[model samples]
Target: MALQARALYDFQSENVGEISVREDEVLTVYSEHDIEGWLEGVNSRGERGLFPASYVQILRAAAGGGAAGEPPASRYANVPSVPPPQPQVAAAGGGGGPGVGSTFCPPPHHLQAAGGGGGGGGGGLVQLTALQHQASGSGGDDDDWDDDWDDNSTVADEPLSGSGSGGGGGMRFSPELDGPGRYRVSTGAGGGRAGAAAASSSAAASSSSSSKSTATVSRNLNRFSTFVKSGGEAFILGEAAGFVKDGDRICVVGGPHGPEWQEDPYPFSCSIDEPTKQTKFKGIKSYISYRLVPSHTQSPVNRRYKHFDWLYGRLVEKFPVISVPHIPEKQATGRFEEDFISKRKKGLILWMNHMTSHPVLARCDAFQHFLTCNDEKAWKQGKRKAERDDMVGGNFFLTLSTPPTPLDLQEVESRVDGFKGFTKRMDESVFQLSHTANEFARKQMVGFKKEYQKVGTSFRLLSQAFEMDQQVFSVGLNRAIAFTGDAYDAIGELFAEQPKQDIDPIVDLLALYQGHLTNFPDIIHVQKGALTKVKESQRHVEEGKMEPQQADGVRERCDTISFATLAEIHHFHTIRVSDFKTQMQHFLQQQIQFYQKVTQKLEEALQKYDGV
Candidate 1:
């Protein structure tokens, strides 16, 4: 855990004990005064040696001037002087011209103009006046910055720190917490997904400019998305419940959203009526048939356990990576056991959850086909239950792990980068969930409520017609359906509790990750600047242009600033990354528990009207 920076070049040692640095390698500076013209450092490989300062550019941002990657210093004409321990600049061969805003001077305007854009003989300075106009935001036209220079080229100077154009004066990006409060930034481009990338980039820039900066977020008022986020989709009763009809595109709603049921929130529950005496025959005993008493349409489908297995198989084939719910273990011997039947019902419910909650697998064509299909012949000819080859093995699924304590910098960075893809998927899932889940839940619940009301009216009419002779059966049936509908209503309430709880944490985490990712690039840039200084010092010593005393003094100061910045960067990043890991684990565990409770509530609800 030493203070470390990335090297920009390869250095060779002429004598033994000299540290040779390789390009793009991260190394730690140990002692500065161990040698003159050469500094002592430890490489990533854990070797200690002396390297000529002229060989590498430091990538960490400096305290006073431009970061290593900032626009060249020549862009600023009247650069202000910065206080002590200025950045070291590598001398270009031929002529040592004006460089480094903190210390190096620029050629006069007359010399720059006469030299025609200041190419050779140390006169390669651009018109500082033009840069001033662009920085002031006064020009109808501005020069496009080029990124063409070889990083090791002797052309001197990084962009001036504290300038209006380039973020300057040694600004650092840090996230600070005030209390137990969560923050989200509103996107300027409304709520479009396209705006997400731009808005995030803008947010990162803004956050880094100050420690108290807030993240920019795209707004999501998507009612359906929010509704499903709360577990409203758990209310879907499947094809047997008569919620879906043929020729419908599968979305979260039980059916399509028309104008009729926009604000309803009643949840769905599917139920099976008691089997008839004829179905109790020895051959049909194993069938254990259940007819879905439709919540919407009257054309309820008859299903048995085998049909569910077929649906499960197709779903696994389609989205193998998604964790499939534990289905009731197949019972070939006790098909008629009461315990077996009850377990099967719960299994079916969990199956629905697995299908609906997943962001990707939830909406697959096979799942839609399973939910809406009612053809008895096809049900009888169910699919094979064997696992698909691709289902169990693929790199597509995210592999998750908890970050270790006390920090391994390389491991931490690697894991963070990996988490980036998964976090992005979470963001997308939340975004999508917010847009459709609420609206779909409301529409379906309202439609079911309205339908239930009609069924109530029909029950009363039928009882009157029968004059109590057959009314008891109708009453029993109506009561069961009512029980199912009531459960839906209660579950809708449960569903609403989740979006705020679940999604807010995700948003917070994304903000954290985005902020961290942003800061990493800045460190590399600053380190490059440090390397540039080392090179300048080395070049001066070798050419005998700088006195021995002056060279020693520059190396000493450079070591202090460089290593100190290195330690600070590592410390800050480690704390934030560790916090990020904790947050991630908390959010994930909460989601798992939330769904488990939801599943239990559903089980209780479904068991209320067994064999009604």
Candidate 2:
């Protein structure tokens, strides 16, 4: 069959610059130079349990730093030398930075003392540094380092050429020898025992307790050199057990300090019991049912966790409960270092949010709210089930054949004004929508006239309205409650209508309200604080420390922040909670009303029939 070639966008790369090519070109697409982006559409469309290849590709692209391509050279003109690549800057290593000291090791003791003497002592075990690991088996960096070549008598696995001067780098392997005798070297291309005499010569053979000489030892090691690299850490279970339950035996391996179960040597297995299971599952996979079985060995649970191996194993009750723990911090270790602790706390926060987000949790919470408030259930179970079914059946994991074009792709020349007017506008639009709303507010606020004379006036009025009727505005609290009551409906609307192109920013804003409003009194409180700050800055102008119109600048700043915060809070309520409630409530009310009217009509018809 003739192969049909296809064209696809090299979205998986960064270096190629945006271009189109035949499908075969993609076969050569390396991890480098691929377009990176969050394939939201693909993820949203695909089933949860089994992500499609396209979904994986999109995720890889997203992880590779998504669509924010390298800035145009002109954009960097005002700034000095091109900012070092992010990873390189991180690699250069510093006291504290995202990727600084990412090498697997423990920091100085003093740094450790600051964090809390020790949380988990083994977490401090250092593994091979990144550079050290990369250097091994790659001929140790220098292209021409052959210290072992001086001894021509030395036999290698490679076939020899000409009278034992057989050293030239190529396919190297050892020929099995038999019997005990010193054999002469054959420099033939097929450097095996060519003649029966050579075969019977029994060279490179050894007696049981012979204490093999240097040459013989080298030959023996080389002959048996079977390189087996340890695969990256992962979980493996022996049997297809049912949901992993507490007290079930399980093993863990491949972590920075050591495997959590730390008993399995390279290629070993063990069972998990209760106490250990409790430790492993704490905040880790609490949402999932699982138990970490006790390990009889103190080493890693997997025997395959040989030297330099990293993995984590746990006895999980179910497949979904298993999780890989990773803390993002400089020089992270199992120890309770400050950064590690901070990250751990952050991880806990994230986990809590995740658990609360579970459908089961949501249903329970919705039920609780309805029972407490004597209101209808906020979430519609049947509708939610349908949505889940659709998600499971439909493919959200479609891979895009093309990638988006960056703003810099068109410009070839270097100049101060390299960017066109529309390009600038478009770039500005990419700035998060909330930021744009804030900018809009700054322009309108009257107090911002001196500071942001260009701002619009509508924003200023909103801020003014907020300040004057704040107590009354407090009534918005009930609206918020109502909105929260209808969260599922709101989420559905947002999920269905959210702009596909720039949804992350919107999603982020929505999340803040879904989780954080309890921390703040109300959106109005945020606005009032901004107003106070603006007034303070205006006081500075009155004191002659600043220009008379500087007060306008402060006001503008206040107006923008206030407006953005309000808009975001309201938008979040509208999308994540209110819409859902409103929709579901309307639906239920309509059904109830319809049934009532139908019963009334039927009764009247029966009466009329009786009279007849």
TM-score per candidate: 0.27, 0.17
Where model 2 places Cα greater than 4 Å from the true spot, the runs are 1-286, 289-522, 547-553, 569-581, 584-612
State the TM-score for model 2.
0.17
Candidate number of the best TM-score: 1
lDDT of candidate model 1 versus the reference: 0.35
Residue-wise C-alpha lDDT for candidate 1, range 1-612, written one tens digit per residue:
123456656776566666677888877654222121244566877777656543444445356653233222221122221212322211222222222120112211111111011111111111111001111111111111111111232322222222011111111010111111111001011111121222223445434422211111111122123111211111110000001111111111111311011111323334455533224334433356656543434456665555455555444333212333434456547666775665555445544543443433444444443444576434222221112111111101101011111223343344434444544565566456545654544553565445545555564465455555555556655555455555555555555555445544444344433433443333333333333444554575576543332233233322322332233343334444665576578768877987787577668656756755
* Ten-residue stretch with the least lDDT total in model 1: 234-243
lDDT of 2 by residue, 1-612 (tens): 111112222223222122223222322111221111111111121211111112222113433454444422322122222322211000111122111121122221111111111121111111111001121111211222233212234222322111111111111011111111111111111111121111122224212112211111000111111110110000000000011111111222233421122221222223322112112324442111112211223332211111001111110101111121221122323433444443333333332332233222222222122112211221223212222221010010000001111112112111112222332443344355446534544443323333322122333344455555557645454333333323323333332322221332232333333333332233233334435544554565555543322234234333333323333333333334643454356546655664455455445434433322
Q: Which one wins on lDDT?
A: 1
Each prediction's number of clashing residue pairs: 47, 74
Candidate 2 achieves a global lDDT of: 0.24
